[model samples]
Target: MEISLILNNELVWDKEFKSCKEYVSNLKSLAPNEVKMREMEAKFLNLVNTDKDVSKYYKIGGALCISLLTNTTFAYADTLGGVSDKLKTIVSPLIELLAGLGYPVTYGMLITGFIMVIMGKKSKGIDIIKWACIGYVGLQFVPFILNILELIGRELRNSL
Candidate 1:
């Protein structure tokens, strides 16, 4: 289970190869494809599974994973409240700019597109209309998308 435990083991080094010269010639008193090799492997696995140190190793690993998840959960627990407030403060100017400049431009595009269509520029008008629709939806629907994400976060936090 641990490096020190295996390094201190004498039989392992004795049975294992030392170098190229010893590897080709030495067999550690055991023939190639010995009958008991499979049984030895199975028993070694069984021993490892039942070992006290191995249990401790698994317990430590599980504890570390749980600790990490718990810490991360706590770290992001206020994502929809405290973090959101700070993020809102940081992004307020951008939101204000979008509201102040984006809607009027989109509305102008829509009206221009309508006029262009009536004047026989169908393709250009359609493209302008499409872009105006996209802009309008981005301005209006983005908050709903954000709310959905906040709801999902709240559910996960509650379940945890």
Candidate 2:
């Protein structure tokens, strides 16, 4: 249950914390500048590389958890109120990429599954074919689902 705090490539604090909140508070108090914060960030990166023990201790949010470690304005994100169009613009590339890859993969899977059926793996082949068709239909529905969500969001935003 020992924690080592490194600053400027040297260990400055080595002790045990009774709780994760205490550890986080101590960490926040220990690193007050960009350099120290960067060092702390590097330590976290190293922890991510070595083991997932750090994740067990900090079980809050996703990458947003890193923002809580800093007070800089740039670390925070704004509400999605004014960014609907921007979100669509960003997601367009993903939808395009999905459409580009979807057909070929689905067809390939269908052909492979048919081959497996001819090769005597009947149940496995049928399962593969079923899954491939399901995936294809789900992907085909993606744009429609997103459109419905967009419409809902628009109505909510307009009502507000």
Reference-based lDDT, residue 149, model 1 = 90
- Give one digit per residue, the lDDT tens place, for model 2 in 14-54: 98757888878888887679988899999988887677777
Report residue 121 deviation for candidate 1 (angstroms): 1.7
Q: For each candidate, C-alpha RMSD in Å?
A: 13.0, 20.6
Report clash pairs, candidate 1: none
Instruction: Please write out the lDDT profile of model 1 over residues 9-98, one tens digit for every residue.
Output: 553432433676676666654575756888898886687689989768766777779989887432335645678788888998998887
Worst 10 residues of 2 by lDDT: 70-79
Could you tell me the lDDT of residue 79 within candidate 1? 48
